[model samples]
Every structure is written in structure tokens, then in C-alpha cells.
Target: MSFKVAIIGRPNVGKSTLFNRLAGRKLALVDDTPGVTRDRRSHAAKLYDLHFEVIDTAGFEDAAPSTLQGRMRAQTEIAIQEADLIFFMVDAKAGLLPDDTTFAGIVRKSGKPVVLIANKAEARGAQGGMLEAWELGLGEPVPFSAEHGVGLPDLRDAVVEALGADRVFGEEDEDDGEIAASDVLIGEDIADPDAEEVPAYDENKPMRIAVVGRPNAGKSTMINALIGEERLLTGPEAGITRDSISVDWQWRGRPMKLFDTAGMRRKSRVQEKLERMSVQDGLHAVRFAEIVIIVLDATIPFEKQDLQIADLIIREGRAPVIAFNKWDLIDHPQAVLAELREKTERLLPQVRGIQAVPVSAETGRGLDKLMEAVVRTHRVWNSRVSTGKLNRWLETILAHHPPPAVAGRRLKIKYLTQAKTRPPGFVVSCSRPDAVPQSYVRYLTNSLREAFDMPGVPIRMALRTSDNPFAGRAKKRT
Candidate 1:
């Protein structure tokens, strides 16, 4: 197990900047806005030879116990308790505020090894403030500049000395490869340029999955149930999660990275700057995930927003598995299940025969089936077809219902081949590609889905005009 370090401070003190700097990537969203980070986010961080898990938490704030800010403070306290060491950060440029002194005392009470970081130390004006930070009495303040990458060596040495070099290094000898901030793996990344074809899915690599849905859709609850732990913050509130928190876990012996994203609302309804950032972070999670599980409220499954979220997932070319959450609450399970199935197929015909797994996040009912569906849908999404087989299938398809004539010329499809997978995409060479109607393309798409056993995953098709050798020949001159 690696050492855990939590960075806690008042809002806008450059804690996130320090987190990104230590992680060697911008994993957390950084802006001038205060309170952008509401939930705690943890990432594998490396500072030269020291390797440990670093948690970036929301700023410490004083608020009523029933308020959101108070709940955020509660979450921070949990991190402090779990962490082996805490980096008490302060804004050197802004000087020490009353809140900083209050939080500093709180950290001192925790009795955890504390490293005082005076951020914005690059500014000459911050020099006086850094000197003032020593009065807090935690320890000597390390004047560090998170943005300018200054004084990081001193900070690292301080951490190493505090945690002890033996404890920091542990038994690990080399640096674990860097994990990207985005954590998104696109088709291009999986495809090998030197190889003749796309490689098979590496089971050794953990599958990146994100749970997304509208506000209060039980997304976080579902993930917590799946992981068998209360790793995420959940409540009656609609938008408790403000950051895309990724947790690594094993599902039936298979490695998986599950991301619990903030509840997404319609674009027009999003107003506050913090909420807007939260939504963007959720979108980033979708892009980064190989499979997106859109959790829906069983009582009201097929709302417009649910369909919109599904459409967004399909548009991103990620395999989607619809999990109907809160199934235990539905009094008429059979009727609602039937209606949900029909609505899913009718409304989202783009991904015909999409998997709709009914699972109760509260009771953990049907979770096994949901994971099975996820694995199956992901396989289909990454499936590849041989060129010979595709052309043979295309021949049968064209023979049954040939392309209609356009401009007194019959459209002829010469060949077809699978271009990529992970949302299978295909390209077809035809005589009159431009004239091929979209309805006809839809026919081909539906036929392909039916023939190839590709259900619940998006399929892309591109029409390209085949080369014509005789047209360019000088037959008229003769």
C-alpha cells in the first residue's frame, strides 16, 4: 500500500495546482473561481523518487452543518482522517486569513504529519506573507510556487523527511508509469500503426467505465454498491458530486476503473460557474470511459433527459449499458420493465437492441446481470469482422434488396470492409456513393446489426465512390 497525502486549505489557495504539478498532469480542473472542487479526488502521484496517492480536496469552509459547504467540510475531514500525511496549504500572496488560522489549528489537532505549503511564493509581494505563515506554528512554511514549478525540490525533500525516506520509498524500486489526466483511450490509441490490423482487447489493462445520468439518478449509489464500499459521497441532494472521481476496483477478478461523475443537467438549466465546471468534468469522464453505464430511475426511466444522455453516449462512440436503478422501489416491476424495453428500442433506434439491465442500487439486486451486460456490450463494441466475411455478408444483403437506380443508373456496391471497432465503423465502396439515400444507409446499418449480432452498440458506416477505370479511357477519340 502506498502512502496517502491530502492537501487541505481555504478556497483558491493553489492546492489543485500543486496536485496537478505533483501528479505530472492536470487531473483536477484549476481556475480562479473558489470552491470549484467540492468532492475529494485522489490520483497516483510521483515526485521524483517518492510515489504515493495524493488527494485534492475541497477548500475548508465554515458553514452550518446542514448546508452544502458544511457537508463538503465533512468530506475533507474524512480525507484528513484517512490520510497518512496532510499538506496544509496557504495563499502567500493573499496572506494568512482568519480561515487559514482556524483550519491550521484543525490540522494540528488531527496529529497527522503536516507539511505547510505557501503557494504563490513566486510573486515577490508574497514574500511578506510567507514570513507571516510561520506564526501559525505548524512548522516552517515551504515557500513553493505551484504554477512556476519553483521550490518543488524543497517541498519533495520536506515530504520525504516527514514521511521518512524508508516509508516514502517502501519496497518499490522504480516509478510507476504516468497515468494521463484525461484517462481517455480513443480508437487511434488502441490501433497499432506498424501492425497490419487493430490488436485484440488487452484483458490485462483495466477497463475504464463511467457511470452517468441526470441529477439524483442514483449514479453514485450504483457505483458504491458495485465497489462494495462507501468510497463516494452520497445523500438525498441531487448534485452532491462535483468532480469526476475515479476509483480502481476488481469486479469478479477483473480489473476495472469506475468513475462516478456529477449529475448532468440540460445545457439551458445550467447556470452557476461551479455547476458548469462539474458538468464539464462529467463530460470528460464519458469521453475517457470505454463503456458508459447510464443509470436511470426505475420509476421514471424514459424521461427526455435520460434519452438525451443516452444519445450523447452513442454520439461519443462509447458502448452504453442502461441500468435501471432503484428497481426495488417500483411496485409494478414487470409492467415498468416491459415499457422501458419498448421505449429504449423505439426512441434510441440508433443503438438498436440496447442492453437495459434493471438493478436496485440500494439492495444490490440484479448487479451481477448488469456487470454481465457491461462485459458483453463492451465485447461487441470492440468486435472486428474479416474483410472476406464482410464482403460476403454485403453480397447477401445486396442480393436480397439491391440498391435502387439513381439518375437512370443502378447503384452498385463493389466492396465493404470494417474500418474500426469500439463502436464498430465500416466503409463501403459503391458506384454512386453520393446518390445513395440515407434511408438505404439505415437499411444497411440495421441489416449489419442483425446479421453481425451487434446489439446495444453504435455502428458507423461510410460510403465512398469506387474507382472507375473505363471512364478515364480515351474511347471517344477512337
Candidate 2:
């Protein structure tokens, strides 16, 4: 079994800060599920070559045993039970409160080796709490300022001592041995640890897919249906999701990291910091995603924020696919789909070739088609075209359509080359580059997208006047 280390403490005690410090990446997908982490956040963590699984759990509060807070408390307790060692963190500046006494008793009884961590200890003011941590009866406290990057070596040593030198590697446990950090965490995850190590079929890493749109748009239902489990908190609440939560899984043998974000609305009435932060966090998910699935309510598909979100994704350089979710709820499905397409074509011309997959996320109606689009778009994003073939294609297209006349002059379209891919962009050299008409540019772009069978991927073409290859030749004038 992989060794597990759980960090437990009250809220705002730097537990998350310490977690981020050790994990070295803020990969946590924060959402509506407050403390008592909705899912076990595990990552490979190492100390001086000793690799193990580090679990950042929700903190426990000393509240009545039957409330929602108590249930959250139970979740943390479960983490404590599973941990090989428990780092009972405390706010060094807050000193010891009655609640700390209540929680200390709970941790003391677990019998698992407890490492008392004094976070925010950089301030001399924390001396009182540093001393108070000793009173928890978990032996000498290991003072650590998780934010200031203080006392890491000592902390590592404390871990070794508690876990034992033999247990440092999982060999001491049974059926497991020296592990790399990723090995430990990825093992418990849904995706194969080998999928990451092995030569997977796809070159692209798990594409970050975000399901976003207005509230009650079946975003959660779609994700649950996709994963075949109720992983997110779904309800009738308009904005049930307060934070973005990501689940790692595989689809058709391709590893994927999917994020389900809170429904985004306009900021006209948003008045709270916590709410604003939640919205911003959701947008951040969209910004990080490779393909954002804008889940729209079938009844009222595209709203102001929906268009805004789609525009933002394009601006962020991420491919977008629209899922008109709750298709079953629509009266005239085909007509509505057609209308939506026409509207999207007009309002969002910048994202020229985006796919609009009409399906009910509730019934798993069109997921296969959705996946097909995602894979197809991703392939387009990673596609590379040879220069020789590209120039040949360009020659045929230019001859067929021809550049439009600029004033009395017939503009000449010259050689072409692809500058980038991932949306497969191209640069075309021409005479009087700026003289190329907008209609001609659109025609060329549409032709490229259609010819390449690149349905949903963004295609970019730029015109530049080429410098004469012999411009630098010395004059032979007498």
C-alpha cells in the first residue's frame, strides 16, 4: 500500500498553503463543497528522495455532532484513519483556543503518529501557539511556517521518524516498494498510472474539458452522465456549484482531465467577494481548458454570458464546442438547432468553425458524438501539414477563386507557408498584402476548413508582402 499523509486542522490555519507548498502545484479544483474535501486530493510528494502520497483533506471543526459541519468533520476523521501519519496543523498566531483543545483530543486518540505543525510561525508572535502545540500531548511540536517556506528539512525529518526509515519506501508495508511521486497518487486515481508512463495512443495530454453555461443547464448532469457517477453536487439551486471541480478519467483509451465549473452570469449584480472569487475561479477553469463545452439549457440556449464565455475561450486560444443541453426539453429540436446555428454564425463569426452538438446531457443522448467532435478538434489542434502539399493546395484554391481587385489593380497572391498549428495557422506572402479584400480572406479560410475536413478547429490565415529574394543584390550600374 502507498503511504498516505493527511493534513488536518481548523480553517485558515495555512493547511492549504502547506499543501500547495509540498505538492508544488495548485492543482486543487475548489468548488461548492466547503471543508471535508469533496474528493481526496492526492498528489505524489517527496522528501529527500522518499516518495509517498500526500492527501490534502478538509479541516475538522469542533461543532455539534449532528449538523452538516459534523458530517464534514466525519470526512476529515476518515482521512485521519487512512493516513500513515497525521500532520495536526495549527495557527501559530492564534495560539491555543478551546476548539483546538477539542480537536487535539480527537487526533490524540487516533493512535496514528501525529506531527504537530505550527504554521505562520515566522512571526515572533506565534511563539505562544508554538508552545501551545506542545500542550496537545502529541509530543514535541515541529514548528513550521508553511507560507514562508520555513522548517522544511526539519519537517521532512519528522516525517521520516514518524513513518520510520524502513517505511520511507513502501517496501516496509507490503506489496509496494520505492515509488516515484506521481506513481503513488496516480495509482489511486481513476486513470492508469501506466497511461501516463506508457506510449499512449494520443500524443496530447489529458485535454482539460470544462462544462460551463447558465445554471440548471444540465452541466452537472452531463458530467455525471459522462463519468457514470454523481461526482458533483447537483440540485435545484440556481448556482449550486461554487467552485470548479475536475475529475481525471479516460475516454476511448485517451486520458482526459475534465473540469465542471459554476454557471457564469453577468457581474452587474454580483456583490460579494466570496461569490466573485467563485465566478473568477470558474472562468479560470475555462481559461485553462483545451476545449470548453458550453452547456446550454435547451429552453433558453444562448444568453449574454454564454456568448461572452464563448468569446473569452476563443480569446484565450482554447477550442470551443457548444452543447445545447436538455434537448429533450425542446419542442422543435431541429428548427431550434438550425436557428441557434444561424445565430451563432452571425454573432460569433470570429470562432468560425465551432461545433454545436445538440443532445440531452441528462439522457446520455449524444455523448458519443460529443466525444467524436472533441477528438476531431484536438487532432486539428495538433495537426501539421507539409509545406509542399500546402503550397500545391494553395495554388489550386487561388486559381479557382482568385484575389479580388483592389481599385484598378489586380492583387497577386504569392507563396504560402504554415507558421503554426493547434488551430493550424498559415502565413501567405502576397503583393499589396493589406489590399486583400475581407470577402476573399473569409472565402480562403472557409475553403481551408472545408477542404481539410477540420469542422470545429479554428483556422487562421495572414497576408504579408514578401521582400524580393534578390532585394539585397548590389547594383551593377556604371
Candidate 3:
């Protein structure tokens, strides 16, 4: 059985740095700013021969139960309850502070095994702080440095002794093996016209969905409601989440992974470096996710930033589902829903027929409809159309509205063929690709969307010059 360990400490105690060291990857964002980590992030960790799960939690602080810091402390308490061991870390160079002493007593109340780690021991004057760490009454402090990999073996030994050597070094866990075929998605230039169609929803592989929007838009609240647990920190304060947290969840017995990303604002308005990093991380999640749920506040829906986020999702070729959040505050549900639908079609014509579900994350309303829309959108995103059917539709479209004349030579539009799926893309061969007007291309795109019943997903069409080697070469005098 795998052991669970929780890293608890005051703000800026290098808990996240140690977490990255144990995880052997930079999964958590580290910065000089205190309280950078606000959520409890867990990952499979390995220390030498010992392998187990480690959780990184927000720093412990003394605040009211209703304050943001208090909510953060509550999350840390949850982590403590779930962990088999606790790593109460402290700064050896800076020594212990009042907050450290106060929280140490609290952690002592828990019956779980505790390992006191004194980080930053490499510094010249750290010996004095290490001496001070002994007063916390947890145990002997293990002098270590998370930045330079100091005292790792001693730390590992303490853990082994605490959890027992047999359980600490158990049988090796099995590997997850190769990625499922359904996970092979997203690349440019689909050369094979006859490649097998994308498989239907593979329930075994977890679907990745990212929830993103502006600050104070209830992104975390929505995710917490879906998981039916306060898995993340939520408060009245804006920008409570700093890291891109991913949670593995299930709905209707289908495995799913939800990513809660930091809120994004306009470039001009985002002045702080940390907020910029958070926004960039959110964008990365949007690009990697299969479907992006753009949450818009119902009180002020369709703001410029909201439209920009939706457009960005489309440009990334990821399926998008808009959630009209804060619906509980809306006075007229039916009228608001109709108005929002109209605004969606008018504002985001690129992905026509997009589903905008009015949802109240505060209450448990419209959640079922929201998920149904998500599953349906995923189906459309991965769909493919046969080449023959595409060519037939292309011929009919061309016969109705022929390409306009450029330099007195009408463009000869050849047959159409699908290049790829996962946000379906197509290739249209024509006589002069450069001469095709942007308006004409938009027409073909709309026509394809309507003909194939593709809606709410970005559709790409590349105009390539018809492949004719002989025609390009000098015509022989015959």
C-alpha cells in the first residue's frame, strides 16, 4: 500500500520547492511571493527507494473562518486528516516565528507521524536557526536544503523509521503502460485521407476539461460543486487560485479529469508578474485540454475578455462550452437564457450553434444539462466525414456559387478532403490558392459546418494549389 504524506508549514517555507524535488518535476509553481500555493496539490513522489503520494498544501495562518486565509487553513486541515504522515517544515536560516510555533502545536494534536524538516541549512548562519527549531517539540529537526538537495538521505531515513522500513520500501508499483490510442490527438497536416476514424468516447481514458474565466467568476465554486467536495479553496476574494490544479473525477461511471486554472484578465490590466504567470499557466491548460468550459458571469456576460477567451479557445482548436454562471442571481431565467443564446451566436459566429448553459454554481441547478452539452460537444469535436461525401458536397457548393474571377481567370475549385479531426480540418485544392478571397474562404467554412452538422468547434480549411506536375512543367510542343 502507498503511504500519504502531507507537507505543512508557514508561508514561504519552501514547501513547494521540496514538493518539486520529490515529484522529480516542476509540477507546482514556485515563486518568491509568499502564499503562492493556495490549493492542495497531490502527486506520486519518490525519494530514493521510497515511493509514495505527497500532498503540498497552503501555508498555515491565523485568520477568521470566513477569511481567505482561514479557508486555506481549512484545506490544509483536510490534507492533514488524509495523510498517513506529516512533514512539518521550517526555515533553518530564518529560524522559527510565532506563526510556526502556534501551528506546530496544532499539528502536534494530530496523531499521525510527524517529521520536522529544517530547510535552508546550507547557509552559513543556519546552525543557529536549526538549534531554534528544536524548541517546537515535534522531534529532532532534519537539517536539509530543498534548493540544493541537501540532507535527502537523512530525511528519507526519518520517514522510513516513522512509517516502518517494510511499508516504506514495498513492492514496486506497476507502470501505466503506453497511452491509449484515443489519446493520440492534435497535429498539423493530416496527409492520410484513408486513416481510420477516431474511436468513440473511450470510457477508460479520462477526458480532460479545463474551466477558465475572469477573476471572481466562480470557477472554483463550479468545480467544487461538480466533485461534490470542497476539494479546492474558495472565498469572496478574487484570484484565490494561483496554480493550475487538476483533479481526477468521475461522472456516470465515466472517468474525467477537471483542471481549475487561474483567472485571466486583459493584458493591459494585468500589471503584476505573478498574475501574468498565472494567466499564462491558464492558457497552457486551455491549449492542452480537449474541451474548455469558459465560465461567464451572468450579471455581466459577453464582456470583451470573455469573448477574447472564447476566441482564443477556438484558435487553439479546442472544443468550447460556455457556462452562464451566477444564474441564481438572475431575475428572469427564461428571458436571460434566450438573450444569452442570441449574444453567443452574434458574438461568436466562428463556432455557430455553440451551447451556452445557464448554470448556478452556488446551487445545484443546470449541472446535468451542462455535462450533457459537454459530452455532445466532445463527440462533434472528434467526428470525421468520409472523403467521398466531402467531395460530393464540395461539388454542389461550387455549382451554386462559383469562385469569383481574378485577373479575368476564374479559380477552378477542385474536390475537398478532410485532413484531420479533433476539431475537424479540411483541405480544398484550387487552381490559385493565393487568389482565394478571405470572404470566399469564410463561405466555404460556414457551408462545411452546416453541411456536416459540425457546430461549436473550430473548423480549419487550407487552400492548396491543385497538384498537377505536368501542368506546372513546360508544356511539350505536341
Top of the candidates by TM-score: 3
Put the candidates in TM-score order, highest first: 3, 1, 2
Q: What tens-digit string does per-residue lDDT give for candidate 1 at 1-478?
A: 3699999999999989989998877778888998878778887787877878899999999998678788789889999999999999999999999999999999999999999999999887999999999989988999999998899899999998788888887875344533543445455322422233545765566688999999999988888899997777787888888788988899878889899998988889999887898889888889978899999888877788888999999989999999999999989899988988998889999999889999999999999999999998988888877777788899899999999998898998998888777778888899878899999999999999999899999998889986666876776765
Indicate the worst ten consecutive residues by lDDT in candidate 3.
174-183
- Clash totals, every prediction: 0, 1, 0
> What are the per-residue Cα lDDT tens digits for candidate 2 across 1-478?
3588888887667776677677666655333333524333556565556666677766677667565455456657777887989988888888887777788898888889988888888887889889988878887788888767889898988988887878876553332221221221100111221122322236545666878887778787788788897556565557666557667778977788788877777888677665676678788777666677888787886778778878777766667888888888888878988899898788788766678788887789999898888777776665655566667888999778788788989998887766665556777888998888888888888887777666666667779997888888998999
**lDDT for each of the candidates?**
0.87, 0.73, 0.89
- List candidate 2 segments past 4 Å from native: 26-40, 61-83, 98-113, 134-139, 170-206, 214-221, 229-245, 267-288, 326-342, 358-365, 470-478
Clashing pairs in 2: 31-243
Cα-based TM-score, every candidate: 0.90, 0.78, 0.94
Candidate 2 deviation (Cα RMSD):
7.1
Model 2 reaches what TM-score against the true structure?
0.78
Q: After the best TM-score superposition of candidate 3, give how far the Cα of residue 266 lies from its true spot, in angstroms.
A: 1.4
lDDT score, candidate 3: 0.89
